[model samples]
Target: MLKKIYPLVFFISLYSYAQTSVNFTDNFSGIESVLYNPANIADSFYKVDINILSSSTTTGNTYSTVKPLTILKDNKFGLNDLDVFKKISSLDATIDTIFKISKLKDLDSYVSKKEFSEDSNFYGNSTILGPSFLWTVNNYNTVGFTTAIRFNGYAYNFNSELYNQFTEKTYLNNPKKLLDNNFGNLTGYGQAFAWYEVGFTYAGVPIHTPTEFFKVGVSLKFLRGIKTYSFLLNDFTSNFSLNEDVPEDSVLDFNGSVSVSSSDTGANYGQGLDIGIVYEKRNKTLPINNIDKHGNIYYSKAPYSFKISASITDIGFISFNNIKTQTNNVDLNLANSNFAISDYLSIGSNKNQKETYLLPTTGHLNFDYNLNNHWYLNTNLDVYLFSKDRINAMKTVSNISFTPRYESQHISAFLPLSINNFGIYKAGFGIKTGLFYAGSSSVLTNLTNLSKEGDFFIGLKIPIYNSKVVSEYKKGIRKYSLLKIIENIDEEENTDSEL
Candidate 1:
């Protein structure tokens, strides 16, 4: 009965996610820079960074589609909007599209044109960094603290029928193909939840020599899980007929866990850790008296030509107590039936034991080059270390970005060109002036009506030092690759790293 009438039931309130601050890759990165690499706190130019307020949101999917017309006159408008179901179903476009697709398989494959499963996954994170601080304790060390509300969610391994149908738009014509068992097996699972987290970090440039320099950083975090829902399918198979005369029997081997707690009742706590290392080349022969290498005593702020860094972060788990779990087996045989689905699986007996949930641990790789005094290019790659098949697991983010920027004492701007592992191609711009920064991951998508996926971020920061000139501003990016320029610089006997 649930399968016969599922088309009329519009599940508009599902799907959510957000990513890290991809735009904070410049001289004015401020306090939030530690979110990427804790060691950055030691390398940044600012003596101190006080974060005022910062927030981010992201929503995108591969299985379903949302008609992108704004809902006005008492309708919910955004991804996190409260009254999602009513607002989503109110649009005529949404209703017609739903009716035409007419089945679960067709509905699942409504968005993409080809290479279906490659994009039929899920990801989302929402973070609000509040009252964060990063202070340079000395010329070579830095300490920082941050608190934020973070939510993560993901879905993957959907049915192959949708992939076959949507690959050619045949699902739209023959809705029965959406029900054909010959289409292949079905397996999909997803989970979403929110948590509160607080973190402390220490980073420093602890080692220096004639040939190399090294920086190390570590962070510790505390987390409190608020709520969670894990939807799963272990060998699940179902079949239903659109024709009333042809009765159908669908069976499923499913299990699920859902837990909830208000602010007053939520007491689940856990810990996470992050460690990073950085390596850079040092000025071998040419050195300045009080600046480069000569007059250095306790701590000297010397510059390096190139650097590479790596970190494994978020190694921890949250423990939710007083939870329940179930193994559900359903056998639905119906003839000429159409009824609304109130609920399918019931919760098991209350289990007071504590259940642990792991954080979506991440691996980071970074590269920075000083092309010239004022010109630089930075690259960062963020990867999730876990597989999506795990229940209640956070999906990994696979994105590689290159940012080129011009920097001055109080102002800077950059362009980020990114190619995401999930086939999302986007470009965005960011600018920082003294105490603030703003940017979006996909600027052009936010402006157009056909936009499918988008995200925006903004933050405020206060730099401690107010110097008239940016530190060790490089000259040009082209000189690093040109052999003639290096030869000319050697002929001139200029040992300024680049020249």
Candidate 2:
């Protein structure tokens, strides 16, 4: 039975990635910002933004301080190659030697040496943003289309004994006491979900005044579920009666209840929605709107002194059909039966089931303060709204983040710091030059072994910026009427017309 769950644990480790990127808040992020807050597209710098491709991944753990990637790196060199190891330094060689010794003699070598809580937890997510675009429709409206493949999974409150048993397998060699009357009582739950989604977004400025500005945005998404798997352990008990004369005749009795469900490889459809609103107090009044000769509207810049925004995202579920569900409820003795414990549990029963798994619905709040035209400070808070008690549901780790950035028309740099609910701190940095950007939430820690989490994100895009910034600013004014722009939509115009 434990063997059946090994793949799920391994999958969690390999697919672990940060939930969101810090660069998503950049002013020039364009379509990428829509994922964090759709309202971010309002008053964007781009006339049109086309995202070619983007990907982000992360690695983290609560019980282990040793970095997984570093261990893999050290494992590449053989200890017998003393010359290669000595080339680094005496300290480096000593550290590598200790790690190799642990790996050779201990099955649980990777487990942390520090004391851990009785119940442990881990969360992971991955995203690949596909081709997407954002288009400024007019002075007050912006629209966008996005497509992505995403994965979310989590394990919560796993007891230390259960975690050790699953992560390590050391059978009873001498068989003195295989089980006791007070043994085999544990409970934990975990789930993993993957999907592909296409989304449409609309953002509009409903109120634009001299000091106060307000914008609202909404996204409607269609989802196709790729895979769904979950397991729950309610109660398990085992007792063994040893046969000293003939060790093979030992008997083990078991009585427990559990449920395992998974969907086959097939299409499952669903829908999702995200809505957000932003309000800003302009540092310099928003520049009056201008229309190109081709009727393309321009705002020139985001002139906010300070702004606040809130959003709700992933509010939907997917219904997976042709699911395989196995529920256990039995009392059996291994010696009395011809089959092993795992074979008995595996052959119990199977029924076709249909289940609906909810997306990792979350809420976000953001506050941004501008120091000047080129520098800004931002803070964000993310929270999960769904119930964690449900074993089949998906969820993201809630976190609070602060980022400071230096941004210009052509280049930008930012540093982001975030802390999860479990108090794990992560520091990261990013750089954006023209249409390309890359960053990581665990960059600082990845260089050291002090932290257990890491992340990396990169993207390429084609951005058509506002042609120019005017010498003088004006508010609540437009050079062309909205009605006149309709006629120009079909006409060819200069893409490089000055703002």
Q: Candidate 2, clashing residue pairs? A: 16-58, 17-58
The list of candidate 2 runs beyond 4 A from truth reads 1-23, 72-116, 162-184, 238-253, 265-267, 284-302, 330-350, 469-499
What TM-score against the true fold does each predicted structure earn?
0.73, 0.77
Q: Report the C-alpha lDDT of model 1 over 1-499, residue by residue, as the tens digit.
A: 2232223222332222123344365546767877777887775666678988887766555543433223221122233434444444554535444433322233343332223452256556667889999887765778999998887766566553444543445656766665543333445666776888899999988786655777899999998888776655544444544543533433322233333322224577888898888887744432321243443332123345777888888888887775555545443344424633335544444345566777889899989886765677889888878875666456656778888877766778888777676667656677778777777666644344333445567788777862311333222123323544677878777656545
Q: Model 1 off-target regions past 4 Å? A: 1-23, 63-119, 163-184, 240-264, 282-303, 333-350, 444-453, 466-499
lDDT of 2 by residue, 285-369 (tens): 3334334476544443435678899999988888887688778766677785467556656434465667887788899999989
Clashes of 2: 2
Every candidate's lDDT = 0.60, 0.69
Where is model 2 poorest over a 10-residue stretch in terms of lDDT?
A: 471-480
Best by lDDT: 2
lDDT of 2: 0.69
